[model samples]
Target: MSDNLQEDQQQAVLCDMCTEEDRKPARKTCMKCEISMCVHHLQAHVTTPVLLQTHPLTEPMASGAAGTTKCPQHGKLLEYYCLDDLTCVCVSCAIEDQHRLHNMKTFSTAHKELMEKLNAEQQALAKDENVSLEKWENGEREKLGSSSVRLIEAVSKLRDIALTSVQTSVSARMVSIKTSKSSMQVAQNEKDTFRFLQMFSQVHQDFEKAKAVDLRKGLEPGSDRDKLVQELRQGGEEMVAQAVQLWGSLLILVDPENHQEVFTTSSDLTFDPQSLGIGMSLSKDHRKVFYNSWLGQLSAHTLRIRSVHSTSNFQRWMVSLSEDCDWTIGLCDKESAENLKDGHVYGLRCQGNQLSSLTTDYYDFTDASRNLEDSSFGLQKVEIPKTEKKRRVSSQLIKCPGESGGDITPRPQKVEVFRNIAASSLSFFSRTGQHQRTEILTMKMSFDSSDFFAFVNLEKEQAQKSSNQPPGPQQQWMCSCGKVYIETGSGYSYGGCYYSKSPQAICSCGRVIGGRVIGDPCITEVVCELL
Candidate 1:
């Protein structure tokens, strides 16, 4: 009874070669033979060289049945493994199935090789994980320390300014008050009647002055102290907001996958007329500028955009130029734009047949012409040949003919500029097709907390024609309240009337001027109270 209980508790696997009445527990299982054997019965596999080499032995399996070892599909013993498919296969499978051309190995060899490969991979991965973790930890600490130091320095500077201003104002007021008090006391101590009378007027005047002297007046609403305080408060708030924005941008920039989305959003920009140099004319939308001719020997004029962008923001824009035009387009900080010849700026300059990087500090037309092959500036000589193509103008596709056809040859070159402030990279790309672009050059530099603006300098000829040009002389209209609305040349007026579509003009005087469909001559007459 006790032996039977012990056997049941052990749940031992009996030797498949033993008789049923005298079955013995198995020590190992031979997968090749599909049988279990006790230690005594396993000696043949251990001593026999052929069986030792061929048979694959494993710890005793509960079911060493032939059915488990046979292939499910072919009903043959699974003898080979397919390395390509990573599966066990039978002889029939190896010869007939999809595993025919795959690299095959015996089951024992495949198992041994797979185990070794897995162990090696595990070790390599462990080492890589440790190294990456250390790097991340160190980088995180460094970033935090640097940011903290900058913030502390800014705060300390602000505090010092505020304290100095307050102390200076308070000290000046206290000195004035003390001087007045001493003068009044000396007059009050006069003993002689005659002297007292003579000093009476001066004493009374000094007393009145002292009484009117209000120390708090320095901190009054319109005083310098008050203004300084307000400025400091506002400045501190702005600094905090900027720090938060910069940190947020940095976090987003850390993920490499977000880079494309971060830098691809295009900015809708217009040229600032105030910044336009002589000889440049802008389109109705202030987007396109034409260089008819230079007014002086300094033919090159830099035009800036009206909108100012933070150095930490991402900005992208495209400039389309005529093939024969010599132009420079790029980004410049506010200070650099003022003095491009002596300041730091990043851009692409195209002169004659060469396209080179535009580093403003070393910018010179002669240098660019002489050093076209200079790799330091990433200069590339490109051919800008005249090509006949259809160009879109004012919502119309104008077909430009060849030189023989007596029509203008269209050769537009579109260059895209990308500014990534987080990475401090300004990249220029040439648009090759509708959906393809080739990188022209990339300028790497550190950016400070300054405003950046897009600028363009035309050296010689005019670039592409403006797409928003009016087909004819723009019609003008006037409201009853004397608001003159100029025609936009796109069948619309500045007064919010779509003359080409559903024509209507609602005056500021609450009067509806005209409501009619396009092509009606009366519609124009009705809306246009011409100035």
Candidate 2:
């Protein structure tokens, strides 16, 4: 039984680095400095040049394994064995102060100790793995929970926009119909009055001709005829005056070359949370998270499409700002062989602070397989939206929770409301008229870092100042590479101030004039123009 157990143990000898069959005797020995060696380090000892210099002709150990041993410090061979203190020391270290204080030892003793310590560490590490696994699993669950919130909000907002659009269309149509009816009524009344006056006037003229003929003939007494004729003339004159008044009023019913113009200004969008940084929470519900990671470099100017299509099939637009002007527009699908062969790539270049890039097909999600390039890793999908309800013209002012007053008073300030002029399928306005149609798109953006997160609404406002005073500072401005524009007090030297409208702020570069009009100001800022 003892013999059988010894054979089983011998068969089970293993390498520290990996799981392999028991090492062969010849392969185990180090050629540079012969000594007892394990399979883990036998090859390394032989290949080391430093070990060969010290023990070029040493013999291998018998019974266990034949190999050379190397000094741990300098990788030198262990040629001269010491018997006093059991520790390995290189030739240089052997004469050092620390080693000189003790009686040095051979390589075998130190090597054995090192192997034993390594085995203990291995066992301890295995025990700790279970704890680490639990922690990792918990973290993953939290991430999933956060992303769910953002996705829900995004989806809900889309639905609300659709419903609002339908309601606005119906309201506009009703207004148009009412105006048309009013115009028709005024025109019809004027025509009726004019016809009546013309008929009466013709009768009076014939009567006058008859009176003249009778007077000339002197056939009858004139007083009765004159009285009758006078009364008839007076009635004709009254009818003619009425007709003139009615005809003048007809202008009100006419759809003249210039009509009453309706002007709508867009409302300013404000964000609830201010700034969200990387890996930050977007909301208190713990259902939203922000992630930002670097994707590979992409050549954004290559997309060329032979045919243009409607924007409905395109994906949502993503705006990233960095110091570099690399505005990227990703598509949901990659160009196939047919597309590539046909040169379906679109070229996008940076013009000042704006990016004028186009995409053959737009993409909402960042999917590399479906998209032409790898998608950003940190983008998350979430939905959390509040719906707006229509109220009467005499509606009470809106107030949030914890307000001291029952209801706040609406400010007498002029509000610029923007209308969707792009929806011309139903309405058209003359360009030269006083009132022109307008449309606006609002982008929901969240800025974040590891610990900070904020959500802000961004939209293009009409060029004219809505308030008596100039507008407040914009929330943020970014370049294509996700770089932010920083404003400085130094007149022209500052980055963003080069194009801002500050009398005190001038371009330090002296290359251009000062103010917003000096250079082409970024579209990120509100720009206004008359149609």
Candidate 3:
């Protein structure tokens, strides 16, 4: 009897619907109703569709524990989530209380939505992390490679200097030793006693001088060669330390979230006069570049701008090109510019009717046409054939490069270039019109050094007038009388409104239209009409 009473007392949860006289153990708890039920009462929750859907069932819970799931004021299960208040509320709280008219969703639906948003955020974060990691790895590799190259070059130069010094010292010592031995041999061959004695002192002095010569003097401490070695060692250590510090700084700057902040728009860029090739001339302000044929040479002339070094940070700039001219614009480091052939340069080139991303192993510095046969990278060559549609006269008037006459694709007037050092990307854009631009191409290449410069190669067929030049006499004109005239020169002749090189010119309507002094070579008065 005591064991039975103990067992009954050990059961912590009891059915709420059961009477105290015949209490039954709980099977499941309804969170919505905040009540524990035995199997007999729980059957309603399983069989009833509304209860199964609306009421969330859980393992048997104690009586007072369910109070937390209900709203404090309404004493109802908090089954709905209020989006506006970012809180959980019961149906009564959502519809009849302060949450009335607020955006709301079922608790399960809100949880699902939150989960989906979290998943998307996780995916975006992962992608950003991957990109940042790739950039960091590439930067490390490039930095290591360039540093190794510099170190190797420095060591090789030092080796050559040391070797040359040692060889020169050895040669001089050998010559002295040979001369001293020859003099001693001559002195030993003398038969006369007096001649032998006379030559003995000089031979002895020569022998002593040859013996005193130090073969390792050039390599000794405080010597020029020794100083060069010490300097190289100290410089190498300093360079390594500086490189490590710079790497740490770069790591801090390479955050994907702040990558855009690394880029800067520089508008005050100017042409580097020293980088201009023959036949290339810059305007007074070093902004505009003009290229004229030199002695009928068909080679291209290259001009470079003193823009930001590509390895330092991201940079962007814009350039305007002359219509109907062969041009190539790109970035090149100091080594590449000096040795254009067999050097890597990233650029976009427009040749004849074809536009392509410039990628060639061997580009002739003096001739852009030589690069046409080279393979292109990233963007495929797009041949822009002449359109048959009748276009504006301005576009048709301009001739293609190397073409005496004929139409071709309209040339892009402006180009915007972006150099992203961190991303190792070079992007090109063609400005189609005001506030509109189309991406030309994006090249992925490493900027190994800080000596990168913006380069442009232009080959113009002939000297052309500026696009801002005034209109000619062939422009249509309209008079105040609403009369339209074509091919009207400085003087007009229409409906007896004759204006010529006279002291005074008048229109048929008795209005003074134009005037010029008689026998004067220049017109004293000029009148312009709008059409």
Q: Choose the strongest candidate by lDDT.
A: 3
* Clash count, one per candidate: 0, 52, 0
Off by over 4 Å in 2: 1-93, 96-116, 164-531
Q: Pick the candidate with the highest TM-score.
A: 1
Which tens-of-lDDT digit does each residue in 280-317 have in candidate 2? 22223222212212211222222211112223322111
Candidate 3 worst ten-residue window by lDDT: 522-531
Q: Which 10 consecutive residues of model 2 have the lowest summed lDDT?
A: 448-457
Q: Give one digit per residue, the lDDT tens place, for model 3 in 252-344.
A: 446422122222235457778786654444555566544333223324666667743444577777777655466778877665565443355
Cα deviation in Å at residue 104, candidate 3? Answer: 2.9
Candidate 2, residue 216: lDDT: 29
Per-residue lDDT of 418 in model 3:
80
Candidate 1 Cα lDDT to native: 0.62
Residues 270-387, candidate 1: write the lDDT tens digits: 7788876653445555665543222322256677865544444676777766443466777777766655555556677766545656553221222223322556788786444443
Report the backbone clash tally of model 1.
0
lDDT-based ranking: 3, 1, 2
Off by over 4 Å in 1: 1-25, 44-56, 64-70, 130-132, 174-256, 259-531
| Candidate 1 C-alpha error for residue 64, in Å | 7.1
Assess every candidate by TM-score.
0.40, 0.21, 0.34
